[model samples]
Target: MVVGLGPGSPDWTTPEVREALNAATDLVGYTTYIDRVPPRPGQHRHASDNRVESERAAMALDLAKRGARVVVVSSGDPGVFAMAAAVLEESADPQWQDVPVRVLPGLTAANAVASRVGAPLGHDYAMISLSDRLKPWEVVAQRLSAVAAADMAIAIYNPASSQRTWQVGAMRDLLLEHRKPDTPVVLGRDVGGPTESVRVVSLVDLDPADVDMRTLLIIGASTTAAVDTPTGTRVYTSRRYHRR
Candidate 1:
């Protein structure tokens, strides 16, 4: 079973995920996600580093083939830039062909962060990962330029990390070509975690330094609007478009 733990907050974890964790004989995942599983007296935990995702999947497959009820955990929805793809890639191995793999969904960061602010994604939007780990930087740049030109809201995942720090700034500069400097942008860090924070700033004012691996950036489309009331700020995109 591959389960999504839902953004580090127990409140976001679905009942299905909780039941899977409870029934798991062996739990395998990155250290942080494995730590979220509630401890069971006889359960075995296999915690690996963030970088060795394929190895972790292989370990889980081995345990499963040996008749252990193994559960693999991902921080958010497993299918979205997480372990599901890795597990699927490894599933192609003939030795693990008969393994019964199951994927459970959870709240992904894009929609989670969008809810915290407002319905900024009410219109067409593009979800892209800025981590060039698996893809080339030039391809990422071209997509950003096209998305900006098409006037679609963009949800940027894996915006910045300790190792690769320049991409976010480069993305900001590229978007400026097709978007105005005053376009609204949102930076959500550790959403649903204890230190959760969401800030709305102009495209020109978005600071790359303020973002890290835990952050998700939402860039508004041309039709997005922000309103400030006594309660706080609310951002939304009109469902209908009007010709100017």
Candidate 2:
């Protein structure tokens, strides 16, 4: 099954995902995602590094090829920037074509963070991963500029790491061209887990030095609005598509 695993918190694991784990003969996922599952008796684990997608999918396919039931794990809804895509990509091989693959949805970091900070994605939004390892920086910048100019709420993934210091600052600068410097920014780190932390601040006050691989940043568009309600200030990224 392709389980979302939901934001790394046990509470986010849906009953369906738990059932998949309990019945699995083998588990395949990144180390951190595998750690979240703990150890169930009689279950074998195949953990890989952050770099190996094809190898991980091959491992799951082999286990299932040998007639073992396997649960491929991923953090946060697997389909959203996670392992589910890799599994499907590899499953297209004729050798594993007949294997029955089930995908279970878990809460993705974006949803988890958005929930905590009111509705930043309440209307239209775009999710962009700032990792230049897989994408060219020029392309990343173009997308950032276009989306920011389009006034869509942007959820940035893989914002900053020790090795990738400048993406966040570059992104901030790009957005500043189209968005107010004081626009609200939501930084969600290690969300939905024990180390979970969240902060809401303005773009001008955002410090790139505070970001890491575990952080997810939500940047509201220039046109984004916040209205005080009984519950809290609700934020929305406007969608001109709905305007008549």
Candidate 3:
């Protein structure tokens, strides 16, 4: 079974995910996510570093095929830029085709972050990952340009990482071409974790240096608005409606 841990917050982990983890004889995932799972008495944990998803998925499938209940874990919703796709892709191999696999969903970072801010995603939006590790920078750039041209709110994942630094700035500059310099942008880091923070800024003021692997960037649409209340500022994309 593949399960999403839903960030590192205990409050965000679903009961179904907990049940899977508790019953699994083996768990496989990246070192960070695997560490999130407590050491179960009889369960074996196979932890690998970043970018070894295929090997990790194969391990889980092998364990399941051997009659062991195996759980493959991802940080957020497995289907959203996470391990579920990798596992499903690997399962297509004839050797692992018969292994029964179940994927349990969890809250993705986009939704979590969007909720923290008012509702930047309430209108038409697109989710894109800025990571060029799997693809090319040119491809990502084209997609960003197209999405910006469409004036869709964008939820950017993996905006900046240790090795890749320029994409986030490039994204901001591209969006600036189509969006106002003062367009609201929300930065969500360590979302749902104890140290989680959500801050709003402008497109021109957004600094890629402030973002890391765990941060998610939300570039609001042209219609997105921000209002300051006594308590704090709230941002949302107005859902246009005409009263009859």
| Candidate number with greatest lDDT | 1
Residue-level lDDT of model 3, residues 1-244, one tens digit each, is 9999996587889999999999999988888889989898989988888557788888889989999999998998998999999899999999997898899999888988988878999988999999998999999999998988888899999998888999889898888999999999999999888789989999999998999998999998888888878767788987783222
The top-ranked prediction according to TM-score is: 1
**TM agreement with the true structure for every prediction:** 0.96, 0.90, 0.95
**Mind sharing the TM-score for model 1?**
0.96
Q: Which 10 consecutive positions of candidate 2 have the poorest summed lDDT?
A: 235-244
Off by over 4 Å in 3: 241-244
Candidate 2, position 91, lDDT:
92
How far residue 224's Cα lies from its native spot in candidate 3, in Å, is 0.6
Name the better of 1 and 3 by lDDT. 1
* Candidate 2's TM-score: 0.90
Candidate 2 pairs with clashing backbones: 1-102, 2-102, 2-103, 2-104, 4-78, 4-106, 6-107
lDDT of 1 by residue, 14-105 (tens): 99999999999999988888887778899999888856778888999999999999999899899999999889889889999999999999
Across 1-244, the per-residue lDDT of candidate 2 in tens digits comes to: 6676888579988889988899988998888888988798889988877758877887898888889998888888888877888889999999898888878887789988988777788777899989998779999899988888787888998898889998888888778888888788889999888898887777877889888999999988766666667765566666554531
What shift in Å separates residue 9 of candidate 2 from its native position after superposition? 1.6
